[model samples]
Target: MKSVLQIGKKILLVLMIIAVIIAGTRSIGMGMNIRTPKNGINVSFYVDINGSNQWINIYGKDIDNPVLLYLHGGPGSATSPIDYSFTRKWSDVYTVVTWDQRNVGKSFDKKNAADKITKDIMLADGKAMTEYIMKYMGKKKITLLGHSWGSMFGANLVLEYPQYYDAFIGTGQCVDIAENEERLYEEAKKWTEGDEEGKVLLSKWSPDKCDDTQALLARSEIMNRYGYGMMKDGRDYNIVATILFNPNYLVKDYISYVKNIETSMEPYMDFFAHGLYECSLLGKYDYKVPYYNINGDMDYQTNYEMACEYFEKVNAPDKKMYVMKGGTHGLLESRSEEFSGYVHDIAKRMASMK
Candidate 1:
């Protein structure tokens, strides 16, 4: 007996209520809070290190576990977005920390001036972060893990402050930049064979021409074209998705990272434009503490062969080169479980050291 207008009004009200409920639920999800494990530690924080504002995430199943400071690759690439997939399992034995170094990813600020972030600045920031973690965790030394550019940074770090760590491991390790580009050029040509367009691209690139940023980017295109770039299993788009959808990353974090990721390395452009002085760890193989390198067989980015060669020259109290078969530069994420298996062995013993 109700009029059509009356019923329609009621339906509209119900629909509006349902829409609000849905929107509220999603907004809450966007800001999901960290749930720490019982008796363990899980925190995401921001700290100023040597004038650079940075972000850090730490997690563990047991607070007493050995601290493991994971230095992500890229003078600009921040891997904390996909870090949980590979580093979570080790939490049982190691308190893992992932950080976004200065002017990159979660640490990037549009208002900040990063043009002065030189090698000395970066190293100073690294030491400050290490000290911060050690002091906060009430530990004397922490295990160090560096990937790609992190391997470059961390390799120099532990060498300079060998007494501060129990062990240091470099995955997707990068050695000499000049030689790295030389070998990458040859391999890129081998894969791009018979493609005229690819040929034209490679002709403009060479080891010595690395200072030209365009050529360097083209090298990435060539590597990505043949599944020899980030990973043999996936492309860069997939990794970007991981970063955007990461539960630990807020909407603001994702926006900042996407906006500045490509330009993140500009701070070190001047120094890197000349030579490998700050970028290469080749020939400097003396380690006061244990040192290790892990590489994927298909990692053309850092060139696995070069990692093996450098591993051979490294002399340390303990050292090993772990090969992840058929893996790529991104083997850490692609082969997370397998990579964790090896790291577990290392973490367990390292955690118990007197």
Candidate 2:
């Protein structure tokens, strides 16, 4: 019996070793397959902003294609690494540029640098970055695409400097954030109506009492738990798979991605709670350039109803609203091909106007 037990233990250890090797090999293999556009423009470099370095990745099937500067969500989150899975296809028709905003993702620095990370500072950085890209590509203007928190930033930028952009595209657009939060809070309560555990968890805070960032975060946590914020189907996109396999991001970048969230959350939370509410541009609907609001029908995070209402009221040179059939906050990732196609068509229309 002792001999048999020893043999079984040896077999189990060998299997464990094999599993580790397989996982390692798969990770390396995926990294090796990281792809860039073939016969297209692909540029990855650091740009100086306020004496600090921030990363930008530009990819396109042809350098002559319309420039699309994508501002990712998560005031702290960087979407460049994961963008490879979906936005890469847009390179065929648009020069897709993904930037790591100040003090986030590849741009995060321990020193905190020349300027504090604030809405105005970020807007200035964005404007500077847009000018740089325009000069580099020899284009007078580029299209601006913003997602989630990015929408807020992009809205302000386009409104402030409409001459620099041909069009403004917003997905998961934020409109009157405080109002959206209230709606989200009510939605969360409604979802947890009969569930004892959900009720207990949600009972900790109310929207009326959620004045600070921590309380807002607590409310968001509960909402997300019931598929109100992120995954409506109770299954999150294996974002880990994208992060782990993305070749553009090294092991250090992955670590920074997480650390930056914590770093950015403190300063950015107030903006979400009060600043956005006080200074929201939802009512300022007149825009100089073409405006497009592309959103998921099921997106509760930003409140689809609010986006539509804003879209209807917003007057621009040209404007349109598209509701992604059954998408959620992750509409871009969930419906990449369709969304890209829509943008491509919009680009063509914008070119005709030019």
Candidate 3:
């Protein structure tokens, strides 16, 4: 019996050691792999943008391909870590780029960023970043694909600096954040009907909770539970699980990705309270370049009905809106491969024009 016990302990210790090694390998992204094709580019590094060290990831099959920059959602939601899911195949057609916006994700710096996240500063950052990308890649103009909060930024950026862009693409478009929240609150209350326990959770939401991330996330959680969340089909979208397979993200990047959502967005609370209500772009987007929007009808985050209504009023040389059936807020992450094809089709046409 004593001899058998000793052998069991030795086996358990070896298994634990092996497990730790495997996990560490995955954490540093060594378990995953990326093969950059001939003449292709796949690299990530820090770049100077607007007096700050902003991080960018660039990948494509051919450097000569048209530049396509993807701006993530969230005033603080950085998507660069998990961007490989949709962008792995994009290099064949586009020189895809993803930037961790200033004071967000890998670009976050507590010492330099003290309440500097504002409309004016972000626009300046966008302009400088656009110039940097154009110069670095030797391109005259590039295309923009903005999602959610990014759509708002992209709209303002192109409208202000039309010379730097060849075309614009928007998904999970942010037309009116104030209107979106109100619509969500009302519908959320309706979902609590005839159910006392549900009402308990619904009571946590109010107009006052708009600037509170924990409260807002709680309300959003309720919305997601009732099928109006990230994905329309009620499939759980787990970024934590998804990140394990992506080679682009180091463990530190993953930590930054999660922590920075709250840290980077803190400065925006005041803007949300004071400036968001009157900030609807219903009729303001008379873009100088061709524009396209890919939206999901089931998206309550941006309010699908309002987006379509606003889309009807947009003016540009070329504009089209493709509404996804039974889609949710994150069409890019949820239906990555299928909908990314939609993006490729749009990008290819724009490249041909250039």
Q: Could you say which candidate leads in TM-score? A: 3
Cα error, residue 93 of model 1, in Å, equals 1.6
> Once all C-alphas are superposed, what RMSD does model 1 give against the true structure?
4.6
Better of 1 and 2 by lDDT: 1
- Tell me, what's the RMSD of every candidate? 4.6, 3.6, 3.1
The CA lDDT of each predicted structure is 0.79, 0.78, 0.79
Per-prediction tally of clashes: 0, 0, 1
Would you give me the overall lDDT of model 2?
0.78
Candidate 3 RMSD to the correct structure: 3.1
Model 1: lowest-lDDT 10 consecutive positions: 235-244
What global local distance difference test value does model 3 have?
A: 0.79
* Residues 152-196, model 2: lDDT tens digits: 889989999998998999999888777877787788878888888
Score residue 53 of candidate 3 by CA lDDT: 90
Instruction: Rank candidates by TM-score, best first.
Output: 3, 1, 2
Per-residue lDDT value at 307 in model 2: 91
Q: Model 3, residue 230: what's the lDDT?
A: 86
TM-score, candidate number 3 = 0.88
lDDT of 3 by residue, 1-354 (tens): 999999999999999999898798666553444556689887878988767899888888898888988888777767766776676656678899998888777888777656656778878989999999999999999999898888888988898899999888988888877777787788878888987867877777775677776677678778777887886553234565557756666667777677666767676676666555444676685889988989888888878887888778888888878878889887887777667778878876775675
